[model samples]
Target chain A: MTSWLPTLQTATPEDGYDLAVKLARVAVKATQPDAAVRDRLRPEYAEDADALIAVSHVVATHFATVAAANNYWRNRT
Target chain B: MTSWLPTLQTATPEDGYDLAVKLARVAVKATQPDAAVRDRLRPEYAEDADALIAVSHVVATHFATVAAANNYWRNRT
Candidate 1:
Protein backbone atom coordinates (compact mmCIF):
# COMPACT_ATOMS: atom_id res chain seq x y z
CA MET A 1 0.00 0.00 0.00
CA THR A 2 1.03 3.60 -0.50
CA SER A 3 1.40 6.19 2.22
CA TRP A 4 -1.41 8.62 1.59
CA LEU A 5 -0.95 10.94 4.54
CA PRO A 6 2.08 12.53 6.15
CA THR A 7 2.44 14.37 9.44
CA LEU A 8 -0.30 16.94 8.94
CA GLN A 9 0.16 20.44 10.25
CA THR A 10 -0.62 24.02 9.26
CA ALA A 11 0.25 27.49 10.48
CA THR A 12 -2.49 29.47 8.83
CA PRO A 13 -5.96 28.97 7.49
CA GLU A 14 -4.65 29.04 3.93
CA ASP A 15 -2.23 26.29 4.78
CA GLY A 16 -5.02 24.28 6.29
CA TYR A 17 -7.06 24.66 3.15
CA ASP A 18 -4.17 23.54 1.00
CA LEU A 19 -3.69 20.44 3.12
CA ALA A 20 -7.39 19.73 2.93
CA VAL A 21 -7.27 19.85 -0.85
CA LYS A 22 -4.31 17.50 -0.86
CA LEU A 23 -6.17 15.11 1.39
CA ALA A 24 -9.12 15.12 -0.97
CA ARG A 25 -6.82 14.38 -3.91
CA VAL A 26 -5.04 11.69 -1.96
CA ALA A 27 -8.36 10.01 -1.26
CA VAL A 28 -9.21 10.03 -4.92
CA LYS A 29 -5.81 8.64 -5.86
CA ALA A 30 -6.17 5.91 -3.29
CA THR A 31 -9.59 5.04 -4.69
CA GLN A 32 -8.38 5.25 -8.30
CA PRO A 33 -4.66 5.27 -8.88
CA ASP A 34 -4.85 5.50 -12.61
CA ALA A 35 -4.15 9.05 -13.66
CA ALA A 36 -5.30 8.41 -17.22
CA VAL A 37 -8.74 7.42 -16.07
CA ARG A 38 -9.07 10.55 -13.99
CA ASP A 39 -7.78 12.70 -16.81
CA ARG A 40 -10.24 11.18 -19.25
CA LEU A 41 -13.09 11.94 -16.88
CA ARG A 42 -12.02 15.48 -16.05
CA PRO A 43 -13.36 17.23 -19.10
CA GLU A 44 -16.91 16.01 -18.64
CA TYR A 45 -17.24 17.67 -15.29
CA ALA A 46 -14.96 20.62 -15.91
CA GLU A 47 -17.50 22.41 -18.06
CA ASP A 48 -20.56 21.56 -16.02
CA ALA A 49 -21.74 24.13 -13.48
CA ASP A 50 -23.54 21.56 -11.37
CA ALA A 51 -20.43 19.45 -11.07
CA LEU A 52 -18.36 22.46 -10.04
CA ILE A 53 -20.80 23.33 -7.27
CA ALA A 54 -20.86 19.73 -6.13
CA VAL A 55 -17.10 19.85 -5.88
CA SER A 56 -17.39 22.88 -3.61
CA HIS A 57 -19.75 20.96 -1.33
CA VAL A 58 -17.29 18.11 -1.08
CA VAL A 59 -14.50 20.54 -0.23
CA ALA A 60 -16.70 22.22 2.36
CA THR A 61 -17.45 18.88 4.02
CA HIS A 62 -13.75 18.20 4.24
CA PHE A 63 -13.15 21.67 5.60
CA ALA A 64 -15.71 21.15 8.37
CA THR A 65 -13.98 17.95 9.37
CA VAL A 66 -10.65 19.81 9.46
CA ALA A 67 -12.13 22.69 11.46
CA ALA A 68 -13.34 20.26 14.10
CA ALA A 69 -9.92 18.70 14.35
CA ASN A 70 -8.21 22.06 14.88
CA ASN A 71 -10.97 23.27 17.18
CA TYR A 72 -11.73 25.75 14.42
CA TRP A 73 -8.22 27.12 14.74
CA ARG A 74 -9.15 28.72 18.01
CA ASN A 75 -7.08 29.47 21.13
CA ARG A 76 -4.18 31.07 19.39
CA THR A 77 -2.55 34.54 19.55
CA MET B 1 -17.08 41.55 2.52
CA THR B 2 -17.14 38.13 4.06
CA SER B 3 -14.01 36.85 5.74
CA TRP B 4 -13.49 33.44 4.19
CA LEU B 5 -10.22 32.69 5.91
CA PRO B 6 -9.70 32.49 9.64
CA THR B 7 -6.48 31.97 11.56
CA LEU B 8 -5.39 28.65 10.02
CA GLN B 9 -3.33 26.10 11.85
CA THR B 10 -3.15 22.31 11.75
CA ALA B 11 -1.43 19.62 13.78
CA THR B 12 -1.68 16.76 11.30
CA PRO B 13 -1.75 16.16 7.62
CA GLU B 14 -5.39 15.22 7.86
CA ASP B 15 -6.07 18.53 9.53
CA GLY B 16 -4.31 20.34 6.75
CA TYR B 17 -6.36 18.48 4.15
CA ASP B 18 -9.58 19.39 5.91
CA LEU B 19 -8.59 23.04 5.92
CA ALA B 20 -7.75 22.81 2.22
CA VAL B 21 -11.23 21.52 1.46
CA LYS B 22 -12.73 24.29 3.53
CA LEU B 23 -10.74 26.82 1.59
CA ALA B 24 -12.00 25.42 -1.66
CA ARG B 25 -15.58 25.59 -0.46
CA VAL B 26 -14.99 29.08 0.87
CA ALA B 27 -13.82 30.13 -2.55
CA VAL B 28 -16.99 28.74 -4.05
CA LYS B 29 -19.18 30.37 -1.43
CA ALA B 30 -17.41 33.64 -2.00
CA THR B 31 -18.04 33.29 -5.67
CA GLN B 32 -21.66 32.41 -5.14
CA PRO B 33 -23.26 33.19 -1.80
CA ASP B 34 -26.68 31.88 -2.66
CA ALA B 35 -27.01 28.52 -0.89
CA ALA B 36 -30.14 27.55 -2.83
CA VAL B 37 -28.29 27.88 -6.10
CA ARG B 38 -25.47 25.63 -4.96
CA ASP B 39 -27.90 23.04 -3.58
CA ARG B 40 -29.87 22.93 -6.77
CA LEU B 41 -26.76 22.40 -8.84
CA ARG B 42 -25.14 19.74 -6.65
CA PRO B 43 -27.24 16.71 -7.63
CA GLU B 44 -26.41 16.98 -11.30
CA TYR B 45 -22.73 16.64 -10.59
CA ALA B 46 -23.05 14.31 -7.62
CA GLU B 47 -24.29 11.48 -9.85
CA ASP B 48 -21.82 12.03 -12.67
CA ALA B 49 -18.48 10.24 -12.63
CA ASP B 50 -16.66 12.89 -14.63
CA ALA B 51 -17.84 15.63 -12.36
CA LEU B 52 -16.75 13.69 -9.33
CA ILE B 53 -13.32 13.16 -10.80
CA ALA B 54 -13.06 16.80 -11.66
CA VAL B 55 -13.75 17.53 -8.04
CA SER B 56 -10.84 15.33 -7.11
CA HIS B 57 -8.56 17.24 -9.44
CA VAL B 58 -9.60 20.49 -7.89
CA VAL B 59 -8.89 19.08 -4.47
CA ALA B 60 -5.53 17.76 -5.61
CA THR B 61 -4.56 21.13 -6.97
CA HIS B 62 -5.38 22.65 -3.66
CA PHE B 63 -3.35 19.96 -1.90
CA ALA B 64 -0.32 20.63 -4.03
CA THR B 65 -0.50 24.25 -3.10
CA VAL B 66 -0.75 23.33 0.57
CA ALA B 67 2.10 20.87 0.32
CA ALA B 68 4.38 23.56 -1.01
CA ALA B 69 3.44 25.85 1.82
CA ASN B 70 4.31 23.16 4.36
CA ASN B 71 7.40 22.13 2.44
CA TYR B 72 5.66 18.82 1.81
CA TRP B 73 5.63 18.33 5.56
CA ARG B 74 9.25 17.42 5.20
CA ASN B 75 11.42 18.55 8.19
CA ARG B 76 9.28 17.29 10.97
CA THR B 77 9.97 14.59 13.52
Candidate 2:
Protein backbone atom coordinates (compact mmCIF):
# COMPACT_ATOMS: atom_id res chain seq x y z
CA MET A 1 0.00 0.00 0.00
CA THR A 2 1.05 3.55 -0.53
CA SER A 3 2.21 5.68 2.37
CA TRP A 4 -0.70 6.73 4.56
CA LEU A 5 0.92 10.04 5.41
CA PRO A 6 2.03 12.05 2.40
CA THR A 7 3.76 15.39 2.22
CA LEU A 8 1.30 18.22 2.72
CA GLN A 9 1.09 20.82 -0.05
CA THR A 10 -1.77 22.87 -1.40
CA ALA A 11 -2.21 25.95 -3.56
CA THR A 12 -5.17 27.27 -1.62
CA PRO A 13 -6.87 26.90 1.72
CA GLU A 14 -9.75 25.13 -0.01
CA ASP A 15 -7.32 22.60 -1.38
CA GLY A 16 -5.83 22.30 2.05
CA TYR A 17 -9.27 21.61 3.42
CA ASP A 18 -9.74 18.97 0.74
CA LEU A 19 -6.43 17.39 1.66
CA ALA A 20 -7.49 17.36 5.30
CA VAL A 21 -10.56 15.33 4.36
CA LYS A 22 -8.36 12.96 2.40
CA LEU A 23 -6.12 12.55 5.42
CA ALA A 24 -9.08 11.71 7.59
CA ARG A 25 -10.27 9.12 5.07
CA VAL A 26 -6.78 7.69 4.70
CA ALA A 27 -6.53 7.33 8.46
CA VAL A 28 -9.79 5.39 8.42
CA LYS A 29 -8.66 3.07 5.63
CA ALA A 30 -5.41 2.50 7.45
CA THR A 31 -7.18 1.52 10.65
CA GLN A 32 -9.78 -0.66 8.94
CA PRO A 33 -8.82 -2.48 5.78
CA ASP A 34 -12.02 -4.47 5.60
CA ALA A 35 -14.52 -2.71 3.40
CA ALA A 36 -17.32 -5.19 3.96
CA VAL A 37 -17.15 -4.73 7.70
CA ARG A 38 -17.14 -0.98 7.38
CA ASP A 39 -20.13 -1.13 5.08
CA ARG A 40 -22.02 -3.43 7.43
CA LEU A 41 -21.42 -1.07 10.34
CA ARG A 42 -22.31 2.12 8.48
CA PRO A 43 -25.98 2.14 9.35
CA GLU A 44 -25.24 2.26 13.06
CA TYR A 45 -23.77 5.75 12.78
CA ALA A 46 -25.01 7.03 9.44
CA GLU A 47 -28.19 8.54 10.82
CA ASP A 48 -26.83 9.55 14.18
CA ALA A 49 -26.36 13.34 14.23
CA ASP A 50 -23.79 13.26 17.00
CA ALA A 51 -21.75 10.67 15.16
CA LEU A 52 -21.85 12.83 12.04
CA ILE A 53 -20.80 15.83 14.07
CA ALA A 54 -17.85 13.84 15.29
CA VAL A 55 -16.88 13.35 11.67
CA SER A 56 -16.86 17.11 11.16
CA HIS A 57 -14.87 17.62 14.34
CA VAL A 58 -12.21 15.19 13.24
CA VAL A 59 -12.11 16.78 9.80
CA ALA A 60 -11.73 20.20 11.37
CA THR A 61 -8.81 18.97 13.45
CA HIS A 62 -7.24 17.64 10.32
CA PHE A 63 -7.86 20.89 8.45
CA ALA A 64 -6.22 22.80 11.28
CA THR A 65 -3.18 20.55 11.18
CA VAL A 66 -2.96 20.75 7.42
CA ALA A 67 -3.40 24.51 7.47
CA ALA A 68 -0.65 24.93 10.04
CA ALA A 69 1.63 22.54 8.19
CA ASN A 70 1.34 24.74 5.14
CA ASN A 71 1.61 27.85 7.28
CA TYR A 72 -2.00 28.50 6.42
CA TRP A 73 -0.77 28.44 2.81
CA ARG A 74 0.39 32.00 3.34
CA ASN A 75 3.05 34.05 1.49
CA ARG A 76 2.27 32.33 -1.76
CA THR A 77 3.66 34.32 -4.70
CA MET B 1 -19.94 29.40 -1.27
CA THR B 2 -20.15 26.69 -3.87
CA SER B 3 -22.93 24.15 -3.78
CA TRP B 4 -22.29 21.80 -0.89
CA LEU B 5 -23.96 18.96 -2.75
CA PRO B 6 -22.12 19.05 -6.03
CA THR B 7 -22.59 16.43 -8.72
CA LEU B 8 -20.45 13.41 -7.83
CA GLN B 9 -18.35 11.80 -10.51
CA THR B 10 -15.09 9.87 -10.42
CA ALA B 11 -12.86 7.95 -12.80
CA THR B 12 -11.80 5.39 -10.19
CA PRO B 13 -12.65 3.95 -6.82
CA GLU B 14 -9.95 6.01 -5.18
CA ASP B 15 -11.31 9.19 -6.68
CA GLY B 16 -14.77 8.10 -5.61
CA TYR B 17 -13.48 7.67 -2.09
CA ASP B 18 -11.97 11.15 -2.27
CA LEU B 19 -15.29 12.52 -3.41
CA ALA B 20 -16.96 10.79 -0.50
CA VAL B 21 -14.57 12.53 1.85
CA LYS B 22 -15.38 15.83 0.15
CA LEU B 23 -19.04 15.20 0.69
CA ALA B 24 -18.46 14.58 4.36
CA ARG B 25 -16.52 17.81 4.67
CA VAL B 26 -19.11 19.79 2.74
CA ALA B 27 -21.80 18.52 5.08
CA VAL B 28 -19.82 19.84 7.99
CA LYS B 29 -19.23 23.23 6.39
CA ALA B 30 -22.86 23.57 5.49
CA THR B 31 -23.87 22.88 9.06
CA GLN B 32 -21.24 25.13 10.57
CA PRO B 33 -19.97 28.15 8.70
CA ASP B 34 -17.87 29.55 11.53
CA ALA B 35 -14.26 28.49 11.18
CA ALA B 36 -13.23 29.86 14.55
CA VAL B 37 -16.02 27.99 16.29
CA ARG B 38 -15.02 24.72 14.63
CA ASP B 39 -11.39 25.26 15.47
CA ARG B 40 -12.25 25.97 19.08
CA LEU B 41 -14.10 22.64 19.38
CA ARG B 42 -11.57 20.56 17.46
CA PRO B 43 -9.53 19.58 20.51
CA GLU B 44 -12.53 18.00 22.16
CA TYR B 45 -12.80 15.30 19.50
CA ALA B 46 -9.24 15.28 18.23
CA GLU B 47 -7.88 13.08 21.03
CA ASP B 48 -11.00 11.07 21.65
CA ALA B 49 -10.67 7.61 20.08
CA ASP B 50 -14.39 7.06 19.90
CA ALA B 51 -14.85 10.42 18.20
CA LEU B 52 -12.12 9.58 15.74
CA ILE B 53 -13.73 6.21 15.06
CA ALA B 54 -16.97 8.02 14.42
CA VAL B 55 -15.16 9.93 11.68
CA SER B 56 -14.35 6.67 9.93
CA HIS B 57 -17.89 5.43 10.41
CA VAL B 58 -19.30 8.54 8.81
CA VAL B 59 -16.80 8.43 5.96
CA ALA B 60 -17.66 4.81 5.31
CA THR B 61 -21.31 5.74 5.18
CA HIS B 62 -20.53 8.47 2.66
CA PHE B 63 -18.28 6.10 0.69
CA ALA B 64 -21.05 3.54 0.49
CA THR B 65 -23.39 6.18 -0.85
CA VAL B 66 -20.88 7.44 -3.40
CA ALA B 67 -20.01 3.90 -4.49
CA ALA B 68 -23.65 3.17 -5.12
CA ALA B 69 -24.17 6.45 -6.92
CA ASN B 70 -21.27 5.70 -9.20
CA ASN B 71 -22.18 2.00 -9.53
CA TYR B 72 -18.92 1.23 -7.76
CA TRP B 73 -17.14 2.71 -10.78
CA ARG B 74 -17.20 -0.80 -12.26
CA ASN B 75 -17.19 -2.03 -15.86
CA ARG B 76 -15.06 0.79 -17.14
CA THR B 77 -13.76 -0.73 -20.33
- The best candidate by TM-score is 1
Clashes of each: 15, 0
Which candidate comes out best when scored by lDDT? 2
Error of 2 at B45 (Å): 1.5
Superposed on the true chain A, the predicted chain A of model 1 yields a TM-score of: 0.77
In terms of lDDT, the poorest run of 10 residues in model 2 chain B is: B43-52
What tens digits encode model 2's per-residue C-alpha lDDT throughout B1-77?
99756677666656766776677666777799999988886656554446557656566567656656766454454
Q: Write the per-residue lDDT of candidate 1 for residues A51-74, one digit (tens) a residue.
A: 555656566556555655655556
Model 2 lDDT at residue B60: 57
Q: Is the docking of candidate 1 incorrect, acceptable, medium or high quality?
A: incorrect
True contacts kept of 2: 0.10
Taking the tens digit of each residue's C-alpha lDDT, what string does model 2 give over A1-77?
Answer: 66343345567999878876775667565445567755654676667787667767767766765566567667887
Error in Å for residue B56 of model 1? 21
- The predictions' CA RMSDs to the true structure, in order, are 12.2, 16.8
C-alpha local distance difference test of each model? 0.61, 0.64
By DockQ, who's the top model here? 1
